[model samples]
Target chain A: MSNTQGNLNTTAEVGIVEDGGSFPPFDSTTYPSQLLWLVLSFGVFYWVMSKVVLPRIGGILEDRRDRIAGDMAEASRLKQETDEAIASYESALAEARKKATTMAHDARSKVKAETESARAAAEEQLAAKLSESEQSISKITAESLSHVGEIAAETTGELVKALIGGRAPAKAEVAKAVDAALK
Target chain B: MAGNSGNAIDPIHQFHISKIFPVEIGGVDFSFTNASLFMVVTVAVATLFLVLSTNRRGLVPSRAQLMAEMSYEFVAATLRGSAGNDGMRFFPLVFSLFMFVFVANMLGMFPYFFTVTSQIIVTFALAILVIGTVTIYGFFKHGAGFLKLFVPSGVPAGVIPLVSAIEVISFLSRPVSLSVRLFANMLAGHITLKVFAGFVVMLTGFGAVGVASAVLPLILTVAITALEFLVAFLQAYVFTVLTCMYLADALHPSH
Candidate 1:
């Protein structure tokens, strides 16, 4: 604690130069030797930073950009494929729909035509049958009248001849009676 | 102190740091010193450390590999915390500065070695380098609009000039503050340690009571030494963190 003379002298020696040297304000005069070296150091540091270190960082960033771009492109490509597939499916569906509708329409029209023609043919057959029935009825009526007429004529002729024979037994009455019977 | 008296205390100083070539434009006294040598040494050491740490190509992580990873993670964590993930880009500069300062500080603890960071010139150079880097990076990243750092956002237009002036003053003070912080901490701690050790030696030479009194300073000195060690690490951390913050500001000047 009381070793003042020695410690004080030693500590005092440190500032002796401080006061004598104007406290050295750290200007160019104080470090005149270091200027060139400082410039050189800075130059080297700047070069390395610009050339090696920064480039590596920039490269990493570029790689990330490339990766992102690639992924986006792949996604877009897949999306395009999906769109094309959907379009193809829709077109095929539309074509099938049109074909089915046409087929249905054609079938319906054919059925209608067939139905109309069949109805017309049936009407013609009915007309033919009606005409044939009318002809058969006429023939049957004609045959029945002729038979009645024949029977009446024969009975009348017979009655007349018997009267004439009974009444006048003459040769002239007998001859007329025989002629009537023969006619 | 007596063992190495015949040899000069510093050998690495022989390597030229900067040699002033004569310039007689306006009677300016320009000369170079050993400070440049240490700057070069710092760079070389930093380069060696980095290259060697990453030299071994092993996934299992050898000692150097582990050290390199730790160095990277240390700076990366600091940057991420201060400047968000954006700071990771500047990890090399921050990590190199931290290692350089840490190694320089530890080197001073060795006998007969110079403390580069203790010199105002060295610390100033480092601080100025950081400021210059951040300034350049900010402007480059944001172009001319980086001047917005001074005006900031959501400030009133009436006080724009005044606030901008103040902001400019503060911005200009960055290098001084950063350098002074490191220089003062190192200079003060070292001097205090030297002074206390002198007291211990001087008092121990006295009688029993003198020796007993030495214990107090000894304990205080030990505590201060431990604190000084923490400060050494802390100062380096603070410097790197501030550097990252400055870099972040430069990267996104609006922040």
Candidate 2:
């Protein structure tokens, strides 16, 4: 609406001249008319937006925001629970490992003690058997010494008989000699 | 009837207000003018656009619903950013202002369509509404303390009177500036476009050489058309931003 519309149009088929003068928008006469309609038009549009369209769109956005926030909160809670579960699981596994280690140590010690006691009992039985065998060997040797003295006295008596007629006196002396030899 | 080849090139002719029906009340001319027709048309089309687009209220949103949502968010964000969440109480008015002006400006770009916002009287009324609400609401909310808006902080006592006077003058001019900014932008862009189109029409009248030369204005007209579209959205944004700032000032009355 400039003031420079002086050269706009002087001839027209509609033959109207209201808009020909320096832009009719600047014309004070038309202000009331324009204002009346602008108010009516703006009022209706505002009513639609405030009372209808805006709220609808606003409601959808608000719903979407709330849903997303709820989902995120749930996800975080689940994650925290999962983390706790993992921690408890790990601790349980460590407890099992400690139990296994103590059980293995007890079993190893028990096996060693049993083997040591068995070995000690076997050694005591072997020592007693060895002493009995030594006693048998000494008894045989004493018996053989007594047998040698007796056999020598008999042989001396035989030799005296064959030598001449006085065998009885030689036998007594040979017996004494054989006995001393045995001693 | 006015679109005859002879008068088709008349740029100012499109702006004429013909009486579709004479409406006079008392001695005043309350006639329904051509401007009123387009104003009604603008509102109907904007309403239909929002209604049809958001009929479904789809969470996923159809194209029309998306557009409707965008328009809502555009003004919503502006209000929240400039005026804070409290300022959202005035969402209806600000959204109406932006959509009405934007649609009006866009409608005027078509042939034979009247640009409602091109009229200063119309834009001024809107500005007055905004500033008027701010003033009334500020006074009601803050009582006499709202007057402190004019007083600059950290000023010398001697210059306090002068600074406050200047501030008051600036505040008073708010409506004028607000209205004029939209009016001038729409008015100037339309005029430039008309001038270029008129050049094409005038040039083509001189035979082959004239028709060939008309291409220059044709190209410029096309270019300006693109620019005007951007201006349409920009002007509406600027208006809403200013309105939000004024409303914020009222709510808080902070300098």
- The lDDT per prediction is 0.66, 0.84
Interface RMSD of each: 9.4, 4.5
Candidates 1 onward: DockQ, in order: 0.07, 0.40
Single-chain TM-score of chain A, each candidate: 0.59, 0.58
lDDT tens digits, residues A1-183, model 1? 135323333332433334442333243454544555555654564455445543443444356568789999999999999999999999999999999999999999999999999999999999999989989989888998667545555555556657676543445554555557656
Give a tens-digit lDDT track for model 2, residues A43-110.
88888888988887889889878888999999999999999999999999999999999999999999
Q: Which candidate leads in lDDT?
A: 2
lDDT of 2: 0.84
The reply for model 2, stretches above 4 Å from the true place, is A1-15, A18-20, A84-109, A127-183, B1-6
Classified by CAPRI criteria, candidate 1 counts as incorrect
Top candidate when judged by TM-score against the true structure: 2
Question: lDDT (0-100) at residue A145 of candidate 1?
Answer: 66
lDDT of 1 at A180: 70
